[model samples]
Target: MFREANSTLVDREWRIAEVCQRLEHDLEVLGVTAIEDRLQDGVPETIYTLRKAGINFWMLTGDKQNTAIQIALSCNFISPEPKGQLLLIDGKTEEEVGRSLERVLLTMRTTASEPKDVAFVIDGWALEIALKHYWKAFTELAILSRTAICCRVTPSQKAQLVQILKSCDYRTLAIGDGGNDVRMIQQADIGVGISGREGLQAARAADYSIGRFRFLRRLILVHGRYSYNRTAFLSQYSFYKSLLICFIQIFFSFISGVSGTSLFNSVSLMAYNVFYTSIPVLVSVLDKDLSEETVMQHPQILFYCQAGRLLNPSTFAGWFGRSLFHAVVVFVISIHAYAFEKSEMEEVGMVALSGCIWLQAFVVTLETNSFTILQHLAIWGNLIAFYVINWIVCAIPSSGMYTIMFRLCGQPSYWLTILLMVAAGMGPILAIKYFRYTYRPSKINTLQQAERLGGPISVSREYRATTTTDRERSCSIINHSTEEQKPSLRTSSFRFS
Candidate 1:
């Protein structure tokens, strides 16, 4: 009875102290409960894949520092090999925290030249101090470390860390499976939520939700990269195709003394987007340019996401130049085939229309590698539809809209001229394609070389070097072309860390 009374008095004193100090709770002796939390399968392999992709992995957990470290080891985030180095920072005072950060910075600077195999484990207090006072130093330390763990961190701290990284120009990706992670998920550039035993609050808040963590490997490396590449290609192709058609019409206007007349009739214009040109791009969207094995073999492709590597100013200019060239070829061929004075205006218009349609078809066909039966049908269907529409419009009485149609669909020479013009216009484009194929450097060869060297870092260096060299070449070309005025192009290199 006396012991119980003493314990009550002590608890009362603790509660009063907590109220006065604004502490979390009073420390009292309580019964311990042991609960087992098993990790999901394939987590280690997933972490390994991310590491190979040059992604920095961090764990912000409410668990104790030791528990977090043990889980990190089991997940292969903390390597078991002797080559790994663990840097611990758990200081209670500002001076202690400063000293710990200084030590980490010193170690990082000393080993900056080598491939680092370091992990950092810091408690909440130390993290707060480092972030508040020595943020730049902390950022450098985190960038150098292979993995980082912040135990006893609140959800707010996780979000703050993500924001800090984003401010530093890092494309942060936050993945979590608990309600406590919702803020972090929202804070990051890409939020991936794991639908695990914790709950679905994080999943609801995330941009993408996955059943297992291992799936993130495929999600980011395969699907993400594919989406970016495919979108870039499609966007460039769409602009090029449209610009080519527009330039052709502009050329026709010049020949016609700036008449500003429409080249194709309403029906053909409608069919171009809805039927003739949509299938190849749709198919290309689903097309996998590189196989899974290729991606896994050369993880450097993942780095392309950092900048506009796939689609940039140089590529856009190339597409524009090609579009202009192709437009001129088509126009010159059609005009030469049917002389401006010899042929009627309607005849010239029909030839121009047919050439434009066929050019679009050729462009679509060239964009794809292999054609499926459905794509083949779409292409043929567009041609058949155009001819059938022309026949119907011709069969109708010569009216307000059918006057041009009546003139164009008259003789077999009209059809023959179109076919000849299409064949003629394809020559330069085909030659250019062959030239590109013959001289273009093979990416597969570079990947094979990197594999033979047995170092992914070498591949990364080679890619950066190639990018730098290309930028220098482009700058030199600009300088030579415009000697009087100099153009400044920003050449910022990507940092994987």
Candidate 2:
């Protein structure tokens, strides 16, 4: 083969034939060479966790079908039960591939009555045929099967699969530990790289990297879920805080005769972002509300991610309405209580600024459920910093801007105005909270109602008509807040009367 390459530059066929001929007779097996690649510790448990989390696992590898099947079995990607069926599809021609795929699709359609778990295994060549000629049928089979594994796939094919799923509007996550997986990882919505013997090429390209595959469970269930929730809350809260400030300024503008001057001093404005409001959000981002044991015990919490129950348009609107209400209360109460002299624009501005800052901090504090020592420090530290900055800015020389604009700092009335503003701004919010907590339906009573009706019940006619027992099992997960025994799966209609 080497001589032919150097001399005639043989074609691929001749090269392959020559290599096979040489290996056929001269290569005597001195000993059977065995290489075993053991599964990473906790991989099986992780797979089980992901499965319960409603995440589908697909194995795309360059290995032979049988080897892939063995690996899949060992990793618990495929259940070991005898009821499970592995459908392998491969052929020398496109026609043969089409027939095999049709058979799998037929089995899937008929299997609901028999209730047999089925997995589909397809090779690169067969996948190419299915994708080109029988795309719709193949997609149906992929969706219907309990699990799907694609063997002998090139890197491009892996990328293609990820792209296909993404095109279907699925939030795909591709995790791999090798150079060959870079394209697929990059193609996914979130890419996770596993740091193992395979290489760092994939890790370098991924959004997150982990030392072991098992950590993926925590990365998705705990960190991913929490991160999403925190980010949503942070986004809405940040908007609300800014909107409150802007609305206060807008309200002051009417009295100031359309003057474009800022209601708060420059130092106070800077402190708002840098000192007053930074820590609450920082603490919020790191807060872990649900315990690891709680999350692991109820894997259905994972389904909430798909439904986007945490942050949506309704939540954003609610935040905006709340902010508008608080802004109105702070503006109206501060002006009515403290703006006795129309000539004292500076005093009014001071009261408004202080009121806004205090109310903003108060609202942030309200959102916090349970606080660690550090979080408590962060929240209190922001308030202390605001006061210290306020005093320092007021103590500056007469030529200084703060000294000129904010002259009400030493007045006891100024502080009293701020105290009244806090009470006024927080009154309605506290009332709403207290009312909800006091009048909220008991979870125990709701569960009793559900049991009385039957299994999980939905009042919406559409939901009742569409929902099946299997779907109820899949959708029902832990409700993070309520102590009810039933899964807190969201329904289209209100569950309680």
Candidate 3:
């Protein structure tokens, strides 16, 4: 056993492949049918791809090192020449990728050209973030490193590897067709899951998944280069823009309140809340949406950075424009209503404003993934809560002092106002996204599968994945597939990249 490239899944795999080839090859030669079948089934696609690419590959399965080489040779995945490029990695034992990360960091001194803020994924396998600033220190640490796959790795180590890669300013995409790849898949820039007997976690975490790993070649070579920075920018920009619109409405709302008259009859505060706030958020969510799995997979710092991108000219302009538009429209309509006593036309103006603001908001995130997933949840949650609170304050007509402060009169206009508000609120978001991602009870449960597959529920604590009879039961997913398979491959489809 020598060194692991970087990722633990690969690390563990190196060992497993070693044992499988050694034991299975000998057993097969001895005519053991079951062992032969297992070895064939366990053959992972990674080895084949690397072989095709003419990259170096090896494993020190406990079988004779020559036998290990022989198995690789039989697969047509090994070079005929015994060049120094081929080194045997002992797969039976788990080994640390580095001795001390602090020491590694010391080697990577921050510099103007190679910033310390960035992290790099060394050798594409280990879970360590080597600061570019400290490359020298990292080199020193490397000098004293142990071979990977001394046998097992923790999930935290997997996450650390991703963080390190990000720091290096490299977009690392992870691919796995089995349960072993779940943690790494969740950490990569993009994860390509392949459906296999290993289970659904890989498929669920991945940006794309296929029945076979070969399809992943297309995704990595193609869309992997697509820039998400723009998408991220627009997403945060849309959210800021919505808030700006609300602020404009609020300012005008205050003016009206102070003057004891409506400042803008273009749209009522309630109408604005419905369309400008609620509808924009919902539609933007659906139209600009990405998989929730994606959001969860990334580090929170990535979102913060993306949100910062919203500070740019285009983003700021969009936000300012929408907010200013609301303020102007409301102010203009209020003056008109005052002179003409056109309060009766509040409905018309409200409807028009709703159509405009909602559409704008929906289009805003069309550049970003519905402004990222967790954000969608927050925006929708806030918007819906706004409506519920509005109704609670305005609709009830109690015959008490309590209702005196909160409830509006039971007039036909007020009832109609509420209905119009609903229409306006729902209009814009719906305009852009005709199709959306939907979840059904019939889908298979990956969490349950993870628990059943002997996966650690809490890796940091200890191994309890398959400790007892409490292990979860096996079940089938009635109907579910990749996010791409859903109606929304991309609705608004906005990305800065």
lDDT (Cα atoms) of all candidates against the true structure? 0.66, 0.68, 0.38
Name the lDDT of candidate 1: 0.66
Q: Which ten residues in a row have the lowest lDDT in candidate 3?
A: 473-482
- Report the lDDT tens digits of candidate 3 across residue range 424-478: 4345444533333223211112322333465633212211222213221110000
Q: What lDDT would candidate 2 get against the real structure?
A: 0.68
lDDT per residue as tens, model 2, 1-497: 65554366448667767766776876767899665555556767877877777766677777778877877787677878999888888887988998999888888888845656578889999999888988888776655654777888888888887766655445677777767778888888788776555557878998998876667778888888788778888999989888988888898789878888877766667667777787777887767655565566555565555556568778799889988888888788777876765635555666776777788778877876556888877877877876777767666676144553345655677778788878877888898877765687333223334445566632221111122222311210000011112223211100000
Q: Which scores better on lDDT, 1 or 3?
A: 1
Identify the runs in model 3 with alpha carbons over 4 angstroms from their true place: 1-136, 139-160, 167-172, 178-183, 186-192, 197-209, 217-241, 244-247, 250-317, 333-497
Write the candidate numbers in order of decreasing TM-score. 2, 1, 3
Could you report the Cα RMSD, in angstroms, for every candidate shown?
11.7, 10.2, 18.2
TM-score of each: 0.77, 0.78, 0.37
Pairs that clash in candidate 2: none
Residue 373 lDDT in model 1? 80
For 36-145, candidate 1 gives per-residue lDDT tens digits of: 54555666776677666656677777777777777778777778788888888868888999998888778777876666578778888899998998888887775556
